[model samples]
Target: MPTILTVPGYQNSGPGHWQSLWEASLGGVKRVEMSSWEHPVKAAWVEALDEAIADCQEPPILVGHSLGCLAIVHWAEGHDREIRGALLAAPSDVERPDALAVLRPFGPIPRLRLAFPAIVAASSDDPFLSPARARILAADWGARFVDLGPCGHLNQASGHGPWPRGEALLSDLR
Candidate 1:
């Protein structure tokens, strides 16, 4: 089976975060460890993602949130690797001023078309990227867009600790 690499946003996904729970439950899931979660540098994060994909024994299915999703897109702009698929969740709108200070550098989303299949899951009520913006991203990346209704940020704060529905969506991609 291909590896599922879970990439968390800034500050990293904590214990109760759905990504962490999914990693614990899923057999072939691994967390892509970034150099610094406090202060994210785009180049560093992109490099780390490249390294993660390179290290995978099989083609990897990327699963990312917020800044992590941006990192994946940024990496895709430069390199096309052995990526089987991707699952992007709750991508932050770097264009928004209220987003984390570290995320500002990633403004004006990059233009990309993923070589492999991908799905972008966006919450209808997410504070970051609006549903329309998420749809645009999915279109640009040639990924399927899924609207997770009323799910705020789709994080622990949104009360989604397990996120079984997301897992099911990911399974469909496989």
Candidate 2:
């Protein structure tokens, strides 16, 4: 069975975050611990993900939110890991000046085809990234895109504390 690695964005996924709830519900799900959650450095975050992928005995299926999704994409740009697939949610647009201030040294926008299958899920009204931008990113990475209607970043604040539908989507990959 493939290991499910949950990666959280800026400040990490707290108890209220859906990623935490999903991790609790799923078997063999683990969080890729970052060195610092409050102030995320791209290189450090990518290194942590690399180490986590290396430590896994089985192929990994990544489930990432917010900046975590960006980290996954950054890592995938050059890595050739045994990744079964990826479920990227709510990728914040670090390209914008306001967002870039937080995500210093943002990884290069990946144009290469990812080695594994991937899904990029975004909300229609996500404050971070627009649905069109998410679709474009998915296309650039050669992954499928799913536009979840008005699901604000799909986080606790967005009213998805226990997202059963998101879990069902993940099941399809398995």
Candidate 3:
């Protein structure tokens, strides 16, 4: 089985969050910890991800949420390491004027195509990103876009506990 690297966003997914829950319940899943989760630095976040990928014994599938999704995009721009795929859920648009100031560093999302197959799962009602932008992102990255209607952010606050559907999506990339 391919290793699954879970990358959390912003303040980090809580214990009740799907990402955290999946980590505990699933096998061969690693949480890529960020030292600056509260005050994320784009370069640092990418570096931590790089280390995790580099250390993996086999090519791992990346699973990211919100700003973590952006970090994965940024990391893909400069790295050529092989990976199974990516499942980017609710990718935050750091370029938005109302976005958190700390997240602006990850702005200007890369438009280049990714080397691996991937999927961008987004919500229609997510406050962090619009459906149009999410579609555009998936297109730019050459990944399939999945719009799940009005689910907010796909996080704990949006009440996505366990998120069995997400496992199905990940299974496709696997």
Candidate 4:
């Protein structure tokens, strides 16, 4: 079975976040700890991801949220490594004015097609991206798109604690 790698957004997923709950519940799931979560540098995050993928005993299925989703695409673009799949949720638009302010280094979100089977999930009411934009992005990356309606950012404040549905989505990759 493939391992699961939990990749969190800018500030990292807090205790009540679904990613954290999934990690705690699932064995063989690991988090790819970035060098700096507060001040994200794309290259550094990509390198950390590369190292984590390299160290995996089996090719892992990446479970990424927000900026972490962006990082996964960046890593896939440069490396030839084959992962089992990716469950990318609520991807933040780094090109947006607000995100560009904090995520300057991750500008120019990759539009290249991913080498592995992947699914990109987006919420209808996510502050970071509209459902249309998310669908377009998923198309660009040749990934299956899932519309998770009205689930803002799909995070803790969105009342997604434990998020069994999201976990089921991850299981699809396996």
Pairing residues by index, what is the TM-score of model 2?
Answer: 0.95
Distance from true location, Cα of 140 in model 3, Å: 0.4
Which regions of candidate 4 fall more than 4 Å away from where they truly are?
none
TM-score of 3: 0.98
Q: Which digits, one per residue and each the tens of the lDDT, describe model 3 over residues 67-152?
A: 99999999999999999999999999998889988899898889999999999999999999999999999999999999889999
Clashing pairs in 2: none
For all candidates in order, the CA lDDT equals 0.89, 0.85, 0.94, 0.92
Q: What is the lDDT of residue 74 in candidate 4?
A: 95
Residue 137 alpha-carbon offset, candidate 4, angstroms: 0.4
Q: Rank the candidates by lDDT, best first.
A: 3, 4, 1, 2
Alpha-carbon runs more than 4 Å astray in model 2:
none
Better of 3 and 4 by lDDT: 3
Q: Count the backbone clashes (under 3 Å) in each candidate.
A: 0, 0, 0, 0
| Tens-place lDDT digits, model 4, residues 24-114 | 9898889999999998989999999999999998889999999999999999989988799999999999887776577867879999999
Q: Per-residue error at 128 for model 4, in Å? A: 0.5
- Residue-level error in angstroms, candidate 1, position 120: 0.8
Model 3 CA deviation exceeding 4 Å by range: none
Write model 1 residue lDDT over 1-174, tens digit each, in one string: 889999999889999998999899898999999999999988899999999999999899999998899999988888888788889999988987687777898766786788988899999999888899899989999999999889899888889899988899889877
The estimated TM-scores of all candidates read 0.96, 0.95, 0.98, 0.97
